[model samples]
Target: GFKIGGAEVSRKHAGFIVNTGHATARDVLDLIAHVKRVVKAKLGVELETEIRVIGDL
Candidate 1:
């Protein structure tokens, strides 16, 4: 069990993730992986990210 690299999944929304403080990219990645694992195990759903390229949506 790791410390999640200083990042955490948002309590207000399941689809959102947030930083604890001075977080690094590794923190966010770790938290995202954890969330995906939990969701897959508990809900039987596989999640993927649809990251925006930049300005356009």
Candidate 2:
């Protein structure tokens, strides 16, 4: 678990995955969806992404 803006942001070990190299906006969006699904299924909490996804996927 890691902290961000006084909130516990993630549980699956932060800094494990990153958008360091050539990560487009769509790539980040996909990653966010995948993470939400995984956390929802495992933790039974519906996680809401803080960022707004614009445009089509």
Candidate 3:
């Protein structure tokens, strides 16, 4: 599992990022961005988010 702040990419599921504790919206968003970047860089694939983010980013 990869952790950034209180957000983590679940060890059991690569596609799921969960809040360990006290995770803010920014933390989740940052982690998502990180995953996208890594996937693109390593696998030459572009990932698109299935969820829509609302509110200030």
Candidate 4:
């Protein structure tokens, strides 16, 4: 699921690497970052993660 401009997004073509539960924000963020880097390098298109990261350092 994703939201844009404060509205729920219903598009299906977007790529999302979701956390499979029991994952901390840090874990998800790290995975998202890695995906962005890899996808950009391999496909030449920049992908953004839709999750918001918050809480503790």
Candidate 5:
């Protein structure tokens, strides 16, 4: 399985992210950030999150 700090992109669907146990909010956020950056750099497309992240990181 593929993962980063307990957060992983779903193998079945690329748009979903799964918590591989013991995952924190920071971990998921970091993973999302990484995916967005990579997609933007490689495809020249900016991804927008449907949910909002509140408070400080």
Candidate 6:
């Protein structure tokens, strides 16, 4: 339940991370990476995404 780069892993939905402010691409990426790392390490699940990344952070 931590926030990374101003993005949060939704408590209601593990699949979504919402930007709480003026978060850029890098912010979301950093949050996603952190989330993946933590989730994989703690839960033994690998996260794969089809989400597209656009613009520079």
Q: What are the per-residue Cα lDDT tens digits for candidate 2 across 1-57?
A: 432223342456653445444656666666666667778999998876777767776
lDDT winner among the candidates? 3
* TM-scores, one per candidate: 0.71, 0.61, 0.94, 0.53, 0.88, 0.75
Cα deviation of 26, candidate 5, in Å: 0.3
Taken over the whole model, the C-alpha lDDT of each candidate is 0.72, 0.59, 0.93, 0.55, 0.88, 0.81
Q: Rank the candidates by lDDT, best first.
A: 3, 5, 6, 1, 2, 4
Candidate 5 has its poorest 10 consecutive residues by lDDT at 1-10
- Expressed as tens digits, the lDDT of each residue in 1-57 for candidate 6 is 468777887888988888888766777788889888988999999989769876655
Sliding window of 10 residues with minimal summed lDDT for model 4: 1-10
lDDT of 5 at 29: 90
**Model 5: per-residue Cα lDDT over 18-48, one tens digit each:** 9988888898898888999989999999999
Report lDDT (Cα) of residue 31, candidate 6: 84
| Better candidate by lDDT, 2 or 6 | 6
Off by over 4 Å in 6: 55-57
Model 1 has how many clashing residue pairs?
Answer: 0
Off by over 4 Å in 2: 1-17
Tell me the tens digit of each residue's lDDT in model 4 across 1-57: 443222322255436444444555555566566667777999998975566656664
Candidate 4 clashes between residue pairs 3 or more apart in a chain or in different chains:
none
Judge candidate 4 at residue 53 and give its lDDT.
Answer: 57
The candidate scoring highest on TM-score is 3
Instruction: Report the Cα lDDT for residue 43, model 6.
Output: 100
After TM-score superposition, the amount by which residue 15's alpha carbon in candidate 1 deviates from its true location, in angstroms, is 1.0
Looking at candidate 3, what is the lDDT of residue 35?
98
RMSD for each model, in Å, please?
Answer: 5.0, 7.8, 0.7, 8.3, 1.3, 1.8
Ranking by TM-score: 3, 5, 6, 1, 2, 4
